[model samples]
Target: MHPRSSLTVLAAAAALLTTATTATAATEPVSRAQVAAHFDLDAEQQPENITVDRDGSAYLTFSFARQIARVSPSGRTHVLATLPAPEKANTPNLGKAFVGGIARADDGTLYVTYATGTAELTGVWAVRPGGRPRRIAALPADGLPNGLALDRRTGRIYVTDSVHGVVYRVDARGGRATVWAEGEALRPSTFAGANGLKLHDGAVWVTNLDKGTILRIPVPARGTAKRIQVHATGMPSIDDFAFTGRGDTLLAARDDNEVDLVRPDGTHTAVLTAADGLQTPTSVAVHGHTVYVPSAAYLTNKDPNLLVAHLDR
Candidate 1:
């Protein structure tokens, strides 16, 4: 990760996100989403990502606060772990240590990404039940690791570097990270790229923030990436997305206060808007038929909260 630049980058990204949402305003809403829990905006409780467990509890990464927290099914919230801050915390684009995208393994181990612009602390962290959090793999000090996905079958973790425009793979047990994929399609045009990642159907799915596109890369048994294919386009400022478990249909969270249902045919419909208590949503998580969205209020700077909705099966 590089040092924080001027506000021009933020302004440009905000404009792109807002424009993309406005273009889809004509689409009819599919779900009436509601805020399940409101965070303390003054205390930097801006949630950057989320993962829901089988027992109905939700784990979240508070980006600006550099903390990981858990919210119970009944709405009780508590801090689970806090990442250490660098002595000179100046992360690329964000200007501070950021804790983003989280994935929960079947064994209840939580893997979260932390970017601090320093090799000493920037990497993937593993948080086990009743245990201290520890770094599993150290990433490049200049790379901004934004999204993470865990392959439980192979016991591996895949990370997306937004600043460096590449994907890194490392063992879940903790070791060095190696470059998994890097191509022109993952490169950023202006602000950030390769922001979200997922493992599905023998392939790796990712989203490019600056390019506003979703990509699918075939993963063979050799752990190498095949040709990258563009799955969908016209999604600007997209942060993270979750599949709805119906074919390839998915819910994509836009940082500009919108959520869209994207079909396998590349068609999309705006299902949720700002009226649904979305204050700059950062990521989406689908557990069964329930949809969870964490709004960080990164740009709007309004109510940061967790929004919930049920999908029609």
Candidate 2:
């Protein structure tokens, strides 16, 4: 990737210095944890992505658990839906289902991704409150669908296929899937590529887990890259992210047990960590200055927990 312009670099440094001063003056980068109540999941549930409804209820996907759960703002949780098991049953050693991403439509519908390429387990699933799981779009068995983003205004859903290093577009209402974008930047050097996703600043933003970078492709993109800009580099293997409703972003670095704060210029600052009691904090959701994280714990000492951290108001 090319280096960002010197002008952009300067702006990021200025932002970084200012943030450092503010964080120092504030004592804590993020406030003490606040737990919510809408959880139907137990310590064993391996929650991957979190997408919140308009009413603030969050729908989280359990990656290897074959289930999706809705946790209300009050932290109450219930089984929202489940993905199907692979036809041959557990492939190799992993679970039959590997649900990856979750996104909520403006109308309360939730879209999720199942990456396990088995049984009929590779596709995008849509569900509403009290509704049955519906396969909205069947992806490729050769690809592992890992990230999801919705352009609700246009009724288009963007999905990332980790294994194939490509992005797919499907009708939010249900229909055929098409290759939306693909480039060398998305190809994984090791295990994962094109992992986390979100629509921001009129572009589709994605994270490469193996590459530890975030790339943004302009909206209405087609073919290959007209341009793919590196939004942030040296990310801590970020899983999924939530835009702060402002220009900043909160990135969940699952393996690092930390949430990284990214500024407008794309320089990430360290914010929350294990000292904050984080345990495999896989995804983050934001409402104003408050950030919500699901700590899957993934066999850690603590049972799976929901962690809340408040940034500057």
Best by lDDT: 1
Full-model lDDT for every candidate: 0.82, 0.70
**TM-scores, one per candidate:** 0.90, 0.83
Measured with C-alpha atoms, the lDDT of residue 241 in candidate 2 is: 82
Best by TM-score: 1
lDDT, model 1: 0.82
Off by over 4 Å in 1: 1-29
Q: What does candidate 2 score on TM?
A: 0.83
lDDT tens digits, residues 1-313, model 2? 1245444433432332233212211114466454443232453476778875544456788776778887655456787777666666443224455788888876678889876656365788988867888888888876778899889788989999877888888889888899888898887878778888888878888888888888898865445336678888887567778887656454545557777877668888667776666667778877544566777766464646666556565
**Candidate 2 segments whose C-alpha is farther than 4 A from its true place:** 1-29, 37-43, 89-95, 221-225, 248-250, 299-302
RMSD of each: 10.2, 9.0
Model 1 lDDT tens row, 190-285: 989999898888888999999988899888789567588999999889889988888788889998777888899978777888877788988888
